[model samples]
Target: MVRNKLILAAAMLSSAALAAPAAAQNEQFIPILSYRTGAYAVNGVPYANGVADYYSLINERDGGINGVKLLVEECETGYATDKGVECYERLKGKGPTGAAFINPLSTGITFALTEKTTTDKIPIITMGYGRADSKNGAVFAYNFPLLGTYWSAADIAIQHIAKEVGGFDKLKGKKISLLYHDSPYGKEPIPMLQVLAKKYGFEFTPIPVTHPGVEQKSQWLAIRQNRPDYVLVWGWGVMNGTAVKEAAAVAYPRDKMIGVWWSGAEPDVTPAGDQAVGYKSLMLQHGAGKFLVHADIEKYVYARDKGASEPGKVGEVLYNRGMVNAMLGVEAIRKAQEKFGKKPLTGEQVRWGLENLNLSDARIKELGFEGMLKPIRISCSDHEGARDGRVQQWDGKGWKVISDWYTANQSETEPLVEEVSGKYAAEKNVKPRDCSKES
Candidate 1:
């Protein structure tokens, strides 16, 4: 019986190995760790679709990035950290040169894979989310929080709040509270906000909400009783919509509440009905609605009926973010091809490309991303390239940009990044790379 079991196990392994297609030397692999069935599905599905569709657009229109065809695959994580790590490990070595890089949509998964990917030499691009301190690329070499970080988001949100209440001087003695999801992703901005509160002289409070966050009456009740002047909502998935609804329930003014880019989406407000009106959130460079890139995605991918998202759902907030994330990766690969001869490149080569990524204004307009992105450049020392964001308010019907773009006060955020990243390097026993020595 033992001999038979061993033989059967070998046969099963052979079959599973045979199922995956043989890798083509000229195809670049991109593993998408997505969550389409979970508490966050409403938001995740659209973002996942956007990611998948952009790759499809490249293949359909440009015949892939610089003739090196993209080999994309999706592994659902259901927003679970363990499942996300499993998906990453399983798909990381699929193509001829292994995965070009990975976009772990979940912050938890990004945290889990950071050390592993460092060993594997694969880049992890967390466009607008992930460890705020990971922006210190000198230490976290393989991590790229490209567009922004939680610390940047925190600073920008406070800047907008300061603008709203007259000036920075007016924040003295003001009460501000943070309604955060009880997880690493939600807690990331706490230290930065604390620093900001001290600097601006505001009384700060943090309230934690359990996962899925469907039950928040107690938290909102406390908010109703205390009535903080402004609440910075750091939430995701159902938590965002629930917070909006609960705020409405407690008679909290929606205008006084602000959310990070993660918390701002149509799904978050639509479920709250009229109560969501006047609610505001930050935009990470781009907002909802279509731009030139959307038109191309429609013409190349959607018009061909090979699109990933539902009809007319292609240009929503999260979907646009996903597209932007994918575009950045493709551009990185293209940038790599400039040096690596355009064939399928290894993870290490892609890392070099990411570290050297420079998206200029002219390049942005040429790539059909004119309005969706801004001029930004990445380097060996700084991984969070662009920290500028705009404020948008949700009307009863849709979203409208209400304020000018506010760049994160780097003088304030950089020192904290250095402190935290320095501690991380010490704990991990890592000798940071010297950017000046890098070619």
Candidate 2:
């Protein structure tokens, strides 16, 4: 009986495996490890919606890239690393193109998948977060922290603040406090910020809060005492609202507090509503609201009333980010198909596509994401296709760009990437694969 049960279980497993490929016979599968209901849901939902919506639009509106549909399946991770791994294992092989690419979106999950992708031969695209050194594609192949990372954000934040204050020299006497989530994601930006503070003679104060941070009264009490010139918010979801409310409670000027892009969204501040007005955030290319392609998305997908997982969230900021994620993923697949011929491309081929992926100003404008993303040209040593970002200010109602595009100080980041990536390689005893001699 036990033997029979084993046979039946094996058959069921085979059936599921076989079924996935057949289901994706003429399509590319992109697995989304989305946490739509979790501590991070306020941010994660819109982002996941945008990603899934874009995939849906591509399949329905564009008729599935050269006659191949894009199949995106979501597995909720609740921002948990272990759940993310489980989802990755379950969905990676089911995709038509060997799971094409993954954007875990969570720093913890990204790190966990960093190991998994290496073994699975898939590309893990963690845009604007994750390990900044993963930009050294030579050292950390299969991991693409595209566009920017926390270090980039920190570098740019300092540069922007300096620009606002005339120069770095003017920052000598100022005190800046970092209100960070007590996790790897929040801590990632510290080294760069501290390095800058030391160079410019500014006082740096660190304030940390546990995740899902509803209790920040004490942290704010410290901030209120220090009364730093500016506060940088490195929070997500409910934490963002709580931080804003706390700032309001302590009578901190809303304008002086700046949020990381993820922290400055509608969901983050909207809960605090008008009370958190004038809050500013750093934007990594795309910001809130609809762009050029959004209208088409609404008409094509939502008008037909076919939503991915969430039907109503078509063109919000996080959703647009998700869409952009899907766009990048699809574009990479398309590029791979250009070289690898067509459907059923392998993970390695997709990697080639990702590394070689280019989004020219003309192309971005053409696609209707002109102002949404800086022109990107990815290569072997650099996985982050672009390194520039803008700042936006929140009116009581919406967001508006307050600054032009600015590149992070690569002079500061290059050495750091090399040092950290090199250490990672040495620790693992892994040598970087040479892109020049690809077979």
In Å, residue 372's CA in model 2 sits off its true spot by: 1.0
Each prediction's total of clashing residue pairs, residues at least 3 apart in sequence or on different chains, is 0, 6
Screening candidate 1 with a backbone cut-off below 3 angstroms (N, C-alpha, C), the clashing residue pairs are none
Task: Indicate the TM-score of model 2.
Answer: 0.93
What overall lDDT goes with each candidate model? 0.89, 0.82
Q: On residues 142-215, what C-alpha lDDT tens digit does candidate 1 reach at each position? A: 99999999999999999999999999999989999999999889899999999999999999999999998999
Best by lDDT: 1
Instruction: Provide the lDDT at 270 for model 2.
Output: 82
Candidate 2 lDDT score relative to the true structure: 0.82
CA deviation > 4 Å runs, candidate 2: 1-23, 308-313, 434-439
Error of 1 at 352 (Å): 0.7
